[model samples]
Target: MNTRKVYLIWFFLFIFIPLIGSAKIDDSHIRSVVQILIYDNYSKEYISSGSGVSIGGTRVLTNYHVVEDIIKQPSRFLAIICLTQNSQSTPDCSYTAHAYYKYGIAGTSAEYQEELDLAVIYVNNKKDTNGTWKSIADLPMSEFSFDSINPALYGYSMTNIQLGDEIQTLGFPDYGNNTITYSNGVVSNFWMDDGDFFKDHDGVLAIGTSAKISHGSSGGAAFDKDGYLLGITSAEILDGNGSFLSGVIIPITTFNWWWEKVLGYEIIDGVGYTTGSISKEMFCKILYKDYDKLHNTCVCPKGYTENSNQECIAGSTPGSDVKIDNSTSLKIDPQLTNRLKGYILLQVQSQGEAWYVNSVDGKRYYMKDGSTAYEMMRKFALGITNSDLAKIPQQGEDKAYLSALSNLKGKILLQVESHGEAWYVHPKTGIRYYMKDGEAAYALMRYHSLGITNADLDKIPEGIL
Candidate 1:
């Protein structure tokens, strides 16, 4: 080769090679990546330290640990991907994701097991179209190869990485408090297997420099000075000096292998390449399924107790009974003071009878022939020559009082007659009650009417008659 030719080749290499390397990544690009938050259903808690990436249009890449259990029992868990941007305010942005794929590990042992730790989750870009999260585009895939020594086995290290390379890793770390904290350090060495740090896989080796990782930073990403992704943050090394110093990362090649298998896609130039439409509904459905399962297995709504049938039933407690003033021409039921303290009035209707009475909170109450409100004073005072006994009114032969009683408490007064229940006047609130014989009628009447059978009524306190 001539000297002139050699000079020209050297110039080209100096300029073009650097440009190609520079094209791989930059500071702005690194900021777009994200950390994932995983929920553990079995423990009913959050797994703060998962790692992930935002692939354009709200789609995210993460480790299977971030969403595996959630997908397995849709009812028990959910996943959220978080992106941090630069703003005067906090840079955090969150997106709910559906687990589209969970790549399985090949073996029980770390060495034999193909690190199938990759997971893909779909985010609804349309729903969150505000660009709150950076979109991923032009991603590289596993099929793409770079020319170098041992590329197949050793994998590509971060470009431009030297013994003293200054690098920054991003992740959500635990501070014992439930929030993410950031840590920074430099590359300690090129490759140092100071024990299982690289060997037995018991812990991470010292390939790069960093402070000890906190609780939630596992699965984060590490970037070189040029902002190109070096590796996925996996673990760290603690030294005998009581100083934690190095972070171990899975080479990018491992990410590529798992990405290809799980996403059914390829990468071009460090960008993930996809070929089909991903549905948002399917993604939400995954979370919804998990939410439903958890909700069902958990406790019932408040103010209710489980019945013999495992169904929720209303709570029961004693209520008051009051008397009416029969001497008054209007025959107004005696207004029971503090009537609202203990019981609610429920109205019910029966085809055979037209009126009935019940008690709550130590008080006997009566409903008019068609009223829903339980007139507390009427039951004790109406047609009663003595305070202990009262005359039961009969509308006609074979047709006794059909109104039912209940004990409920609420401010709103419901009109029971509109639903074909009998009307009765309330002495305390002056509201009218109508009786209907179903649960709706009882609820509408705002009473404790439990659709109690005649047999059940026999169990009431003797004073409740």
Candidate 2:
């Protein structure tokens, strides 16, 4: 069979038969999972079912294949979410809601379903007391109860999950009568998709786990022991004889690309940071552990103050600061300071303090404090574009940059190709730290501070531009 045809056959085999459960899971996690029921548009008769987990609000994330047929011909098919289980442990038809067509990736090619099998569906209608589907209006929007994964544990930029980490899968499988099932397993392999599109991507696209999932488990949840949603129950790998091999999962990193790049949602640490997405109370609570400590990071949307220097120092009061003047009468010839570019000079005549020579302008800036150090690093950064930066091997990529770093210590490099972000190359470790802002520069200064004589600083003249 062709690859696409074989995948179609595999998708059908993996999506319909009842799925997951042998290990115990929390009740809250069980309640958050739902069964996706497909029905005939005209007859209202149940056709097929798959599993999904609530991400937030009314959105449920699942495999694209589970609803692919309905998406192809919405006029002939309908999809609804079953919120609870009946006496038979199957998805209860009573507590049901119709899914509102929402954002999802259908993929550019059928062959790419192995990497692109994901979708987001929304539930808008709920069954009333009279068994009639009505617009959900029973409770206050704030009172809507739905279990969601903590954003902190969503693990987008996280990489602590190793090859042998334990994992669990939760979904409804056919053998389990379309009821929520949980299974425990270990991550066996981490691999990329067999396509050019994702082969060169940054991280692992899929994970092969011993944790088993079945047909109805297509969109269910795979969680780490700490409740971090590792991925979704996506596919099953079979041996040459069509026997079970290992369950394949669509890793959260795959979801990260679609959720952020495709959907245009601003995600900060895996949580939507847009308006009406996360409340200030919830944001502070999640970040600082106390709503009142919002000032600690100065990241809150409102009520933060800036100093006369326009620096957003945490807990600084307005009108209580004086700005430092960058202007000076000191003069130095370009010829005299040109060779000292990118050098960290020490003033032996003073307190034996060190200063940075701007590689771009060939000027010396004092590293008086963290704030000043940050300002000076930015003012002196050498604009190296990406194509140019790539030529300099910071690591094993190229050794020329390393050779230069040996002589040019305490250099400030600016990636002009990017957002012009500044970075400080440590004099000893040769490591680079992102100078995010004054606060970050302050921390970098303390950690990478070096002492030298004042006589060396006097030899270098400050440049006036």
Candidate 3:
């Protein structure tokens, strides 16, 4: 080949090759990078701005300072801007959300030796005008190192990485107008032991990347060559003229350590995302009980009760003592309702989203879930009828008080039902037990008022029990 042709080809490759690589990185991850805009609830004005990375589910991990106002006054005066659309262009921000205080944030403090300036803000569930849910893109799950937090393993292990290994970083730098900003930099320092991010104490390790972390880039992620999140970019040390100098990063290993200490779950290899989908069969097993269909094994039987040998016995019948006359008048479609059938009516009136055969009129009663339904039948059964339901703390009212009641379960005359979760008295001791409302049919819960007497046992022939 001629020297002129060779020079031209090299020049084209030099210019276009980097551009292609940068474009590919942005294309794959721009959606997962979120721009967080905070606001004051009372004044209805904009607060400070920063960036966040979705660890998964509805949770966004950002610097604690980013949502500091929220941590101070949650459910009092705080609002969050959620990017519900593709954030590549102008992010399609949805209806302002002050309702998210319920979901809450974790680790919002300047403590942990200022080492933990991290917070995981939870985005609340909201529906748009079309009744569709507002969704945010989740970052790909990245594993954490379980070996140990050290400079040698993280800073200089990979063949492609060295002491001053070049790294490609992306974040929402306000200088880039809050759009996804890309910067090429190198590993500046590894603070696994003798490092900065602290003045005195030999605190936890941190990463110092030379990436251009501009304003609004706090809590953004730093990725490696293969797009694995290495750490989170927190701050940058600037020169007197306010020019960028060195950036301070919190390694993903730091987060993994904190998460293990606090949340008690491991996130490496995508084991602890919490929101990852599971099959319906597995779903029934994990939260409520244990079940594996392959060997046809479960902790309890199909009827959800154990036999003399402690083995699960399937298809057990309801042992309701009484029966109601003309029960057919109270029958309803079993497909739409979860009420147990053929059980005798227990109360005069019933409430919640279930077909109820009223002992008073013998007519079917249907009410929304969570209201006052099973209070009467429970009263008759255990004398825990009225004010006790009012006194027992409802879920989310006082978590601590209910936690205390758990230890007293045996001492108290508590009747634990599946879905109907009112405090029923222990006909003997009369102590209260906080029953978490569940929907296992074998337990005869109050989620849907299955009347005292089973009227339509045949209507709902099949159940998860």
Candidate 4:
């Protein structure tokens, strides 16, 4: 049945190829776009829905309004990002991503809502069969440069795009949830002032289009000739007679301002991992705490506690006080300095004892021992390589316990254990810790921080035999 739908979609594309007379739509980006499912927490059911595009590794950009309610009360809502299977319309893989960071929609006055209607969401990776964080598919990042000092990143776009130029939009229209829908139209007009397009909009530039944009199309990408991206689909403009006149788009330039102000990094090249995305070593240094990406600092919001795992969660628990090697004060937590300084460095500088190592940027920590370091000592106390530290076969979750201990005793041997963001093993002598760990650790951390009490830690993949 789905095969027929796919065939018919291609057939329509072929039939309209010459008649549409617009920029050639690049189907190569099909994998980059995804359908979003929004669910209200109390009802335990899907309430609203929309579409999104992967802008970075494990990061999706969608309309801030689409997830506005969730941002206000994140504990009451959740979003799932689904990767569509090519042959079928149903999701082949889905990850629960959240609006960990956002901007634009500030005051409560319902006067201007469209000013900065953008948001950044994060997708936690699934553990591979061997318990390593497998790299999930993401959309390619734009190569356009923004700043000379940091470098700007943008998608494909025509130079000095003018009015009346044709556009091809790709997104999951509400009418069709099985496959991505495409529409072609020309830029009919541009709104210089924010509210120029609509009386209720904020002060920002918007493009008016004659394309057929439906309700669920918000947050979808709008591309110009040669498959370069122009802006994101906002909504439709209605005439005084309640008729569809034209579609509206928030220009990519405006989004750049929000991206820089919040994320503090550039996706110079569309593949955003080099600097834009977070890494495993950096994850450990940051300690899985709920942080404001805008300032690139770890911060726990009001009413939430950062567990030993460094995750922000509801309620409170005794301080696990996870260990941090070599740092007299919290001022320069060497554990958290990867992107700027460099990783795994140790030297006797004039300022007493000091060492610096870049510990940020890598895959999420999995039990398979992907070479992330837990502690930087005068010398690695254990001769074992960092990779070997994780090489030991991970144990089952049932055998593990959650505790803060000064010494390793009474805990199950080889059994994985964690308190907050950090996982550890009590070797009957001095304990050893994994900067990150198996699915059990991930679930238990979320179990506390996200209130996912129903999570079955046993189902989490076990790395060790």
TM-score of each: 0.37, 0.49, 0.47, 0.48
Residue 52 lDDT, candidate 4, scale 0-100: 73
Cα lDDT tens digits, model 3, 1-465, are: 000000000011111112113323544355455666666656676656766665543446677666666655765444344442233566544523322222221111211112367666655434456866432111111211001111112332233444455556656666776566777676766555554432222344655666677667776767766566666778776665756666767766656544433332334334311223223344234223355556433344223344453322223444322223545222233232223221222343433235333221112334223332333233212212133344444444542344433322221112211122334322123244353332222133343222443334333322221
Ranking by TM-score: 2, 4, 3, 1
What CA root-mean-square deviation does each model show from the true structure? 26.9, 16.2, 17.6, 19.0
Which candidate has the top score in lDDT?
2
lDDT of 3 at 24: 36
- Write the residue-wise lDDT of candidate 1 on 375-432 in tens digits: 3222221110111111122223342332331212122122211111233333333333
Model 2: per-residue lDDT, tens digit, 1-465? 001111222322222222233344565666567888777767667667788777765566778888775655666776677754322355554433333232111111111132378766665455656777543322233323445543334445426776667788778776675567768787777765455444223466777777776677788888876656778888777666876667888887667654543332333243421112223344233222234442432232221233342222222232222222555322223344545565566555666465676653344667666667655654445444455455444533334455643533456666633445667766555556677777777666555554445533443444432
Residue ranges of candidate 3 with Cα displaced over 4 Å: 1-23, 76-88, 95-114, 130-161, 194-204, 271-465
Measured with C-alpha atoms, the lDDT of residue 446 in candidate 3 is 40
Return the candidate ranking by lDDT, descending.
2, 4, 3, 1
Q: Please identify model 1 stretches exceeding 4 Å from their true place.
A: 1-31, 40-47, 91-94, 101-116, 125-160, 176-182, 189-206, 239-243, 260-264, 268-465
What is the lDDT of every predicted structure here?
Answer: 0.36, 0.55, 0.43, 0.43
Model 4, global lDDT: 0.43
lDDT of 2: 0.55
Cα lDDT for residue 136, candidate 4: 28
Model 3: what TM-score?
Answer: 0.47
